[model samples]
Target chain A: MEKNNNHDRFFRELLSDSSREMPFSDFEDEVMAEIRMEYEKKFSGRRNIRLSWLFFILGMLSGIATVFVMSFYSANQPFAFISDNLLPVGIVFICLTIILFAEKLVKISFRRDNH
Target chain B: MDELYIKKVLDGDIDAFRYFVHQYKDKAYNLAFSVLKNEFDARDAVQEAYIIAFRKLGKFRGRSKFSTWFFRIVINEALKSSKKAGKEKYIADTRTESVDPGHVEINDIVSRDQQKYYIDLAMQNIPSKEALALTLFYIEEYSVEEIREITGWTESNTKVLLHRARKSMYHELNVLLSTEKKTLY
Candidate 1:
């Protein structure tokens, strides 16, 4: 038992002596750079989502404004084709907006869950 | 303290992660070296591990100490590197052999100047798992339970590995010293 203890102590001392110092001085910096890159990628993804939403909102508002303005035009006006198809056009626009919004929301929620 | 830094990193404070990198780098390097046995490979493994930890930091549930979790990543990365370099077969072959210690005197053979060199050589000769077990048990002074936690091994398996590791380490040291003795005389 005593011999085993001595051997254990000796091995411990030897192992401690063999413990090495890291050679690379810039190790932390290298790791941090990679981490920063990942952070930037995530930040850019979020920015892209925000930009998409901004464009979507702008497009939706412009569609509504165009329809509203066309409503005041006579049937013989140059935009009569648009006014004649306004209701169906509005329905299709609303459905498409809802689908795009739902897709964006799903993607954001999926990313959040992954993180 | 680690939790605080983890929270800061998760909160998008990228600089806060430097604290962890500085704190664990050396110890993590040593652990990586124990498995890979090459300075450059060990360093690359540790760097990769740190990047992995950072990328996966959000999934950290704080169930274990940050060091334990990080060390596990370091070991896995080192093991993967060793496997890629075709060194895993060499490490695996060393584990099954039992060496007879004979009558070698460790203290008489190892001089102060050569102590670190011979010990490192012996560690390199042993199986990587045994080397890792010895480093965590002796150098790091972690309990068997803690080792089990870090390694995801069962309690009995951890104990058995430690026992075999100690025996293999002593045998390897004896062989190294005996070779040195023959070379000297």
Candidate 2:
């Protein structure tokens, strides 16, 4: 048992002494550069998604407001046509929103799984 | 301290990751070298590991030390490179060659000032897995449980690997020293 302990201690000393530092002086810089590129790539992807959602929400809000205004001002000849088609327009808008939302959700889940 | 850096990195301070790189680089390189046994391959493995750790930094839940998680990445990256290079066969072949002190080459032993060179050469003769176990247990001073955690190996498996590693290291060092003595005479 003592002999085994001695051997272990000896090996430990030798191994510890043999421990080496990374020889590359710029190793940290190289790794950090790669990491920075990856970070930018990931964040840029997220930013693009956010921007797309912003545009989609803005477009949806404007479409709804236009429909609401036209329905209220139905007495005008130009909006009378819109007022008659308001139900179909609302349904189409709702469907589009749902489809876009579902698409975004699927994309997000796929991204999460990939990561 | 590591937590602080992790938080900084998570907060989008990309430069904060440099702290981890500087801190763990040497040890990670040593571990990589132990597994791959080729300096360039080990370096590439370490770089790839760091890149992976950075990409997955957001997923770090802090259940363990960052070093532990990072070391696991390093080991996995090294193992992957080792597999790709088909160095598993190299390790197995070395394992089958008996350590014959009589056949020890005088040119293989270095002067006292180059003891580390001699030790590294000795390490090259052992199985990579055994070398990795020895490096984690002896050089890094990690406990067997920590090793198991880092390596995802069972406790008994880690213990057995450490035992075999020590035996191989001892025999290899004996052969080296015997060669040195023969040269002296």
Candidate 3:
């Protein structure tokens, strides 16, 4: 639904053509390998997206586990709620939500600065 | 991930570089061909693009996908190569060139009609930047936002360029195509 026009179709075709695929040749392999090697060294200074996604996935798993444990405790220990992990889980949810929101601050540049 | 090969290279292997070269040279060349439309320039442009990308790989934060960043680098290289080579020329010499049935060969692919191939050809003789803009938007199908990133134009600027570029392509393409179709074919 987002892209349902001739132009969209046109762009799709064009995008497919733009990929860096070519006939197999010794030269092609050499260039790809060379660039990859060169980048791996230079990209060492910062955690690349691949590495960042790894951490994000770990965070997601931890948060999921935390939520599950806290939810079970809240339902089972309805009377001794203070001892339940619910509060901590709630706090974690709030904190992590804010942190994720904060990470999106830079992306707001695409927004029209109405000022 | 080239995985084991990357591991060896990281461990200070020089032969690994050769393997790297073996892997992506043709891909890089094809990228050039897509944009520059010339085999010789595309080959050189890809080689040059790879070298520049290699040199600046440290700066690549992977804010975008790896291939997207690499594509940007190659596009820049092709643009630069076009400038040095001057406007590219096109020929419709019906002499034993490959063509698919019902797919008209417009010298300039941006022309409105598929009839006059020369119109597309004429586009090749114009400014490389404009030509590239048309090709990217129409042929490569990059979004205006994506074009903004690739060409370093703001969103509004990209929109304006695309509008003007399309108009120009249509005008140029029609000049050759429309009249011929009405009179000749």
> Model 1, range B106-139, lDDT digits (tens) per residue?
5577677787787778888877888888888888
lDDT of 3 by residue, A37-115 (tens): 6556545623443465566667666766776666666666463574354567676775677578447533442333211
Question: Which ranges in model 3 have alpha carbons more than 4 Å from their true place?
Answer: A1-115, B1-37, B88-126, B182-185
TM-score of candidate 2 on Cα atoms, chains taken together = 0.75
Q: What DockQ do the predictions score, one after another?
A: 0.54, 0.49, 0.12
Model 1 alpha-carbon drift over 4 Å, by segment: A1-4, A53-105, A113-115, B91-102
Arranged by lDDT with the best first, the candidates are 2, 1, 3
Instruction: Name the 10 consecutive residues with the lowest summed lDDT in model 2 chain A.
Output: A106-115
Candidate 2 vs candidate 3: the lDDT winner is 2
lDDT of 2 by residue, B91-120 (tens): 332432344323434235565556777778
Would you give the TM-score of chain B in model 2?
0.84
Q: Point out the worst 10-residue segment of candidate 3 chain B by lDDT.
A: B93-102
